[model samples]
Target: MILARVEGSVVATKKNAKMTGNKFLLVRPLVIDSPTAKEWKPGTSTLVVTDSLGAGEGEIVLIVQGSSARLAADDKDSPVDAVVIGIVDTVDVGKHILFKAQ
Candidate 1:
């Protein structure tokens, strides 16, 4: 799994039959400065992910890819490469609190 922030949403008028009702979101991966970092920073690249948990823009989320993503989706057969599995509330790294949702 990876930590990411929802940057925005994606609307597709036409898509694969299996992905008819899925909601897509643009997410930027979050990276820590170090193992004991006090904050999270957004990575340079972005990814389009399928969301089922109603995650909103600016919210930190947990993402799963590949086969795990397929399993996370309501339809296991949905053509998904990534999926938002959880909305993050906090992230504690060792003795440091890296993130806390507001």
Candidate 2:
């Protein structure tokens, strides 16, 4: 799974039949500054991911990519290459709390 922050949304009126009602979100992958640091650093690229978890903008989410993306969707044969599988409530590294949803 990849750690990402939902930056925005995507709208598509016409798409594949297998993806008719799915919502898509713009996500920026996040990486921790270090193992001990509580800060999350943004990755260089962003991805349009199918939102399986109803994650809103600014919320941190977990993304599953490649063939696993289809597994996270309602349709087993979806064309999605990436998917937002879960919304993160909190991220704790040992005694340090890296992030907490509000």
Candidate 3:
């Protein structure tokens, strides 16, 4: 799993039959400055992920890829390469608290 922020969403009126009702989100992966740092920085690239947990824009989320993503989706056979698996609450790295949800 990887930490990411939901930057926006994707609307696809026409898609695969298995993905008819699925929601898609645009997310940027979050990376820590350092092991001892308490800050999270946005990754350079963005990704579109399937969402079933109703995650909104600006929320930090957890994402899974490949076969794991398929398992996280409502339909296991959906052609999903990435999926939002969880909405992050807090991120604690050792003694430093990296993030907290409001």
Candidate 4:
């Protein structure tokens, strides 16, 4: 599981058969205020994450384990390794509002 933003969509003319009908999203890692980790790969490369979280452009989301993701997407045979599970509109860390979805 990681924190990433949807950079854009992906189109595969030829792909795995199980991947058909599944929306493939290109993601860039996000950088939050972290004392330990200072930088993030915002656009270095893109990951193909399943859109189980219903995340739109620029919306921050929560990604989870592939097993859990398989359940979320209702695709037991999906070979996806990464899955976006939640569309986070707001995040509260004690007295801080970390993010607002859109």
Candidates 1 and 3 compared: the better one by TM-score is 3
Query: TM-scores of the models, in the given order?
Result: 0.92, 0.91, 0.94, 0.73
Error of 2 at 69 (Å): 1.1
TM-score, cand. 4 vs. native: 0.73
Off by over 4 Å in 4: 36-45
Q: 2-89 in candidate 3: lDDT tens per residue? A: 9999999999999988888899999999988775677779999999999999999999999999999998785677799999999999
Question: Candidate 4, residues 55-98: lDDT per residue as tens digits?
Answer: 77777667765688777777878787778877767765566666
Count of clashing pairs, candidate 2: 0
Stronger candidate by lDDT (2 vs 4): 2
Error of 2 at 84 (Å): 1.2
For each candidate in the order shown, give its overall lDDT on alpha carbons: 0.92, 0.88, 0.92, 0.71
Instruction: Give the C-alpha miss distance for residue 16 in model 1, angstroms.
Output: 0.5
Candidate 2 colliding pairs: none
- In the predicted model 3, the residue pairs found to clash are none
Candidate 1, residue 92: lDDT: 89
Error of 1 at 38 (Å): 2.3
RMSD of 1: 1.3
TM-score: which candidate is best?
3
Residue 19 in candidate 4 has what lDDT?
81
